[model samples]
Target: MGRVSPPVLPAACEVLVVGAGPAGSACARTLAAAGHDVLLVDQHVFPRDKVCGDGLIPDAHAALRVLGVHDEVMDRALRAAHVRCVAPRGGHVDVPGTLAVLPRRDLDDIVCRAARAAGARFAAPWRFVAPLLDGERVVGARLRGDGIEHEVRARWVVLATGAAAPPLVAAGVCERRAPSSVALRGYLHHPELAATLRELQIVWHPRLSGGYGWIFPGPGGTFNVGVGLTASHASEEGGRASMREVNLRRMLDTFAAVHAPAAGLLARGELRGDWKGAPLRCSLGGARWSRPGLLVTGEAAGSTYAFTGEGIGKALETGLLTAAALAEGGDDAAVRARHEAALAGLKPRFELYEKAAHVNRLPWLADLVVWRARRSPRILRRMSAVLEERQNPGRLLSWRGMTKLMFE
Candidate 1:
């Protein structure tokens, strides 16, 4: 239960990974196990809080299994039986799948520890200043910590810096400056709710148009509750402006006002801390995947999905992909090509999720889908498959799918 940053800073390593969340830690673990000299760094101290829904879907389970930490995570996680998807009109469907919840504070620390166990050197509370460039190629980075600046050089640099724009901009790889979406969340402790709420609850309503709210039961009689909005960039100048008039706190209030479960949770549960919000970079198109000597993974590479705003699984996947690409032993061009090709393979699935995000914009569509799912076992299974990443979400979320739903 002890959390402390490493006291020493290394002068160099073969690979330098910034941001010690799931992505960076996964990358470090894989590379370190492969006998690479890896330096993993993060700005925050160990066990720091991250803004997340904290629900681990099936895809997340798969990635954790790949990291050989699935059993450990499950032991620490609050197991969920199904997901209750509530529509705008209050119609709902329960889709069964592999689901669980563990706060990011604990989940991240586990992954970071796995990296350390695999022989990756860990340093934290170190802020990434800028990439150290040799001509057009990145050689390493300049990091400031403890009121001192240090230069850490590496043959390869991996940026797993999540959705923040400043680090991406500093590295000269930021394509869209602003985040694609945003979410606000807080923790609540209610023994009754935790005892009774076995399913993860997700509610969509007209009041939260282009967004949704969730109440995920966690261990220790706590619940993670939040609202998230997918920003509409079609009408904006550069596809970067978030909804100008949207207030997340107001949105949370609106959600509680419209949803009974949220209202009950708020009325009965004791809130743990101030509500915190974070930006999300989704759709996998915001940053360049690779420059000559560097690669970007995780939410920094837009690994979060639009429809669900889930990033942890894909973040771990992308981190592993980056590690595999670099570990294959290649020239710079070969490594870049491998990384780009790997990300390209994941693009179609991300695109399908983006298409499914239409439900976020037209929330009434959720009602329609839920109405049908309530009656159709096939549709219910499809929804479950989408959560498991076994089926294309577009198959059920598209107009073509809706048309079929009507005739069937």
Candidate 2:
């Protein structure tokens, strides 16, 4: 029963967005800007900590501009023009592009505020309990907050709850999938590293296979350091084994000690807090986009880039794309089909990234690419395009592009 006890209020809106992160905010702000009434809800308030590397590449910059918060974020976060990638053989290449390091606490608040500023009603501490259904179609969501339970009815429910797999799981659009990749991130105060930090750095570990570590310069004198291992790499030591079997905690500690760049920085600073880890469900562009009236966006829909484990930009992009579809003002089915068709545009790039995720396992290939790029300005620029997401992930798969990348 979609019941709300007495004294619990009921509200109706055109659209109800489940999470206030980048994807939800992007969708709500766009919808509200287009003259639709939107109510955005979240389980937590703004300015709270989240486990992320806190690095924003060029694609993220584009999303912020669409949200009208690009200047706000850029004004606060430190900037860089290049990313330093170190291969397992210790060779390095500097890929030119704009990047920044702003903590998730700050970034999420900026986006959420943008949504509110756009006239979307904001509600926090309201946990989405389940989809309020009319037969088979979702009409809204049952929520719990303030020691009371209620339902917020809307024409459509947007699931931007992210990696938690919340509303989707409850509504039976999906299940709690396992760890396709594992990541742990923490902050550190390193004034020395901060003073000289000009670029975000990534390092490929020779023995970790498909895993990489990163050091991003955060606001103030802080640095964000972390490691990630894709499922392919995780299953290597033991079939279908978890993070424990891979000794993820130990691996991060070892990388921080021996990975030259990371070691130097950690040695010069003290840890800020305990490392936070999370499992990810990557690009599910292959899965169902919508069932009835609910649509999943962001990491919930698998918009993450498997190769680099990057998802923020894709999340925001997909959110805006979804907003466009919903704002078309058609019936639910038409809106869903439109959104599904639009998402197909992301599949080619995702398939290309799937191939790159496999290539990440080979140390020699990474070494060759980095070494060649270091020697070839054209190749270096092209490689940078890959990170900036300006170039398709498939570009490197082309014979012509590969020949230039190898021989130029």
Candidate 3:
């Protein structure tokens, strides 16, 4: 990982972005392109690993387009994704979509490069220690890098600090709702699964309880496989039972039985190691994302898809929207009003998906849904479209093709 040396901060700038992930980079790129002097800072260096499935849906690509980096990223994408949904009863359904797989390290680097090219100054390995306040208003942030601390001021600040919104919430610039679930994931090498790398497989086992396991392929025959469970269920079951180990074992067992013996593949590829788990926060409920000069976006703003555990896409979308709102040059109240209006239009459908995930309380519901989806091509297509946000029917249960799922 290469680090960019910190540049001397001017007295103040138009915008200051903390935590340069997808959201920060996207916001910086958009704002800078619109001729705003923007400073983007991150705690890590370039090409740093961010634990994610690394799956890019069509909507994500659309977000990249809004940031003007879609073509560049697509040129480096590894594969077009084919989604496979597996049930506890062993039923499965494969639905094709406009999805792609790319490592997060690479993806973030690409986005950061675009932002830099768009004239946003970047400082990596710079920790955002605290927000610099001018009385009751947020003026900028205090950053520490290379063992020295400095104050960088800006007219407006955008917080993209991800899951740990950090001191911002404590500073009263942001707030958080309770997270519904937690996710565990890690990377491994599974050559036998390479051919199927183009296909992103999600296994919904009843034993997992409220969450599913997934296997996503990355560059050079590496795979990311992990499981997620509702926090409440995980707590009730026990804290130290090793969800990652159990899920990895289950995945390897399934893979070996189904595809191991095909042309000496098992000998070539075997279960590599254990999967690591990370916490996942659900950004479903309506919440205020901004305060005064400080605006929040991405995971910090609760923009993740509760059901799919997809946050990068929504994060990017919020980044673009935030940039647009800032570009209009409004006061805090005006920018906040525009931001809330934009989110209001999208929150209902997201809430519906969150509700659907919670509603699958029955042990057999996931299996039944998968079985019916496999039997009906329309169901599979609709489900894929809905999950990818290519189509929004508003009511998840009211879709005629999903009636079997609703009844089950």
Best by lDDT: 1
lDDT per residue (tens digit) for residues 120-158 in model 1: 999888989999999999999999887778999999999
Name the best candidate (by TM-score). 1
Candidate 2 lDDT, 1-408, residue by residue in tens = 333333333488889998888899999999998889999988886667878777898789999998899999988998888888888878888888878889989998999898888899887778888998999999999988867788888899998887764556786776434556778887888887788876888887666676788888888888898888875324334343334356667767777765776777667777888778876667654235787889888878888888888888888999999999998878877999888888888878877787777555765667777877777777777787898776775566444545756665
Count of clashes in candidate 1 = 0
lDDT of 1 at 109: 96
User: Per-residue lDDT tens digits of candidate 3, residues 181-224?
Assistant: 56666666666567655677777665555666677776677766
lDDT of 3 at 186: 60
Clashes of each: 0, 1, 2
Better of 2 and 3 by lDDT: 2
Residue 315 in model 3: lDDT: 83
Query: Which window of ten consecutive residues has the lowest lDDT sum in model 1?
Result: 232-241
Clashing pairs in 2: 283-302
Candidate 3 residue pairs that clash:
184-277, 185-276
In model 2, the runs with Cα more than 4 Å from the true position are 1-10, 232-244, 285-287, 397-408
* Model 3 score (lDDT): 0.70
What ranking emerges by TM-score with the best candidate at the front?
A: 1, 2, 3
What residue runs in model 3 are displaced by over 4 Å at the alpha carbon? 1-8, 231-276, 284-287, 359-363, 391-408
Instruction: Score residue 29 of candidate 3 by CA lDDT.
Output: 92
